[model samples]
Target: MNKTENSRRRGDELLESLYNATMKLATTTKLTNLTFQQIADEARTSRTVLYRRWSTPFDLLQDIYSYKAKKLFDGAFFDELKDNGSLRKDLLQLLTVYQKVHTEIGAEIINNYYFLRAQDKNDNNELLIHKQAVEKHLNATKKILANAEKRGEKIRKISPITLMLPYDLIRTENLIRPTNISKKRLTMMVDEILMPVFVG
Candidate 1:
């Protein structure tokens, strides 16, 4: 390969290919059955390229999920968070978009990485991933709180457990429902559960 082409492949283009390849395979192959050879073949890149960065398919999968989740945070749904008029309204919209992005990232992968595999005592990777996801949502919530503050709404200091209600509620519901949590249920969560905490 020419130096220019090789350079491009070594850059974002290569990472993108690897991420795409991983997700493509993940869609059909259970994580237990996934192989680096399959990912390398799908990406049309060498195992050397994969090995230079990742030691195992598990590591690559973790990075792929982090990349995908980060992109979702940077996407257009965030703009929709602007001035949703009330904390309750803003949260409902925020979580609807949040759940949509999570759904797009695929629940099976999340379930494996975050919940199911926790029993194996894998490592701190899942904890880090969980923290990253929580921070992104809370950062978005910060905006909602700021906007609510501007509109003369009261904001309160919530304990960590109370602060986590939105994420836990949505996450639990998603696990039960699996990519299909209803708008009605979300509304009820925001109104009946979340509104009391944020606006109480």
Candidate 2:
């Protein structure tokens, strides 16, 4: 292979290794116990390599969260949005995926990091990284909503800030316990609770 091709392949390999190591760390270790050294050892690389690519453990963790969130949304949410056609159907699918990720992985990691950073007042960079990662996910959802708007679908006229309420409510366990929310119920909630405020 040419030198340029070899260099690209090496870069891809490094990213794959890093991603695999991060996934292992996310699933296996509590956020409090995850360390750069642990990740490096798990990936079969050295601390220096990780440090060369990421400024701190938080940076590495942020990259991992971003990667996982993107993968989940791309695999299910985006695909459903593209195929579902109707705005209501797309929004319901989006909400289901959003709730699952928030309650399952995203909220746990983010809440842990937020609590940790709050206790460590000196860790401004960690807080900023976490905030940015969250904003990126939120912005992607907004873009999807915007696309719906472009398609002549009526989006609720609620404040953009309130767009996160449904997921936040689910994450906070406001709904009945041990009950799976049906797509029809989600659609009804959006239409009844959010639509009058957002779409009207």
Cα deviation in Å at residue 134, candidate 2? 8.9
Best by lDDT: 1
Candidate 2 structure quality by residue, lDDT tens digits, 10-117: 476877777677666767787667787888777776677778779877677666655555544343434444536655665566677766655555554545444455
For model 2, the run of ten residues with the poorest summed lDDT: 1-10
The local lDDT score (0 to 100) that residue 20 gets in candidate 1 is: 83
Give the alpha carbon lDDT tens digit for every residue of 1-200 in model 1.
Answer: 54334334867778987888787887788887888888877877667778889988888877766676664534555666567677888888877877887788778666655643553484556535455656666666776777889999999876656666777787788778874578988898898888888884
Whole-model lDDT values for every prediction: 0.73, 0.60
Positional deviation of residue 45's Cα in model 2 after best superposition, in angstroms: 1.9
Candidate 2 to native Cα RMSD, angstroms = 7.4
RMSD of each: 4.6, 7.4
TM-score of 2: 0.53
